[model samples]
Target: MFKYAKRLQYPINIKKKDINMAKQLITQYGGIYYKKDIKK
Candidate 1:
């Protein structure tokens, strides 16, 4: 699961259409959250 954080350390800017779609696919597969791998 992914939790909405206040902000991400870096931005996720996908400009290219193809690349953007790929990013979406990856997000759907593994998700796009920090995975609580912060401040740990």
Candidate 2:
């Protein structure tokens, strides 16, 4: 089953990895926001 995270899950090792790629991945996981003022 799927679960929600209340805090930091684990320590990620990004040594010698591309910073930009990491940022993009994190942003993508942030999901989408729905606003009442926004139109579909």
lDDT of 2 by residue, 1-40 (tens): 9997777668767579776775566567654432333344
The clash count for each model shown is: 0, 0
Worst 10 residues of 2 by lDDT: 31-40
User: What lDDT score is found at residue 40 in candidate 2?
Assistant: 40
Q: What is the lDDT of residue 30 in candidate 2?
A: 53
Model 2 root-mean-square deviation: 9.0
Query: What tens digits encode model 1's per-residue C-alpha lDDT throughout 1-40?
Result: 9997798888899665785565566667767663443242
- After superposition on all CA atoms, how large is the RMSD of candidate 1? 12.2
Candidate 2 structure lDDT = 0.58
Q: TM-score for every candidate vs. truth?
A: 0.36, 0.35
Which of the numbered candidates is closest to the native, going by highest TM-score?
1
- The Cα error of candidate 2 at residue 21, in Å, is 0.1
The worst-scoring run of ten residues by lDDT in candidate 1 lies at 31-40
